[model samples]
Target: MGAPGGYGTGFALIVVLFILLVIVGAGILRF
Candidate 1:
């Protein structure tokens, strides 16, 4: 079922992952 809600959820998940990766990278660089 390719519903509109599914797309929105997937996009949100990707965005969250990207933000987390950025934070982790910054922390590693700080060390």
Candidate 2:
């Protein structure tokens, strides 16, 4: 059976959030 579509989208969102968190943490450390 084929994989469900929502799984891909959810995974992408999680990745984006993780990247955003990393960027924010780096910015905080720069100060």
Q: Highest lDDT: which candidate?
A: 1
TM-score, one value per model? 0.87, 0.85
- Give one clash count per candidate, in the order shown: 0, 0
Worst 10 residues of 2 by lDDT: 1-10
lDDT (Cα, tens digit) per residue for candidate 1, span 1-31: 5669989899999999999999999999998
Per-residue lDDT for 1-31 in model 2, tens only? Answer: 5768898889899999999999999999996
Quality of model 1 by C-alpha lDDT: 0.95
Clashing pairs in 2: none
Deviation from truth (RMSD, Å), model 2: 1.8
Which stretches in model 2 have alpha-carbon errors above 4 Å?
none
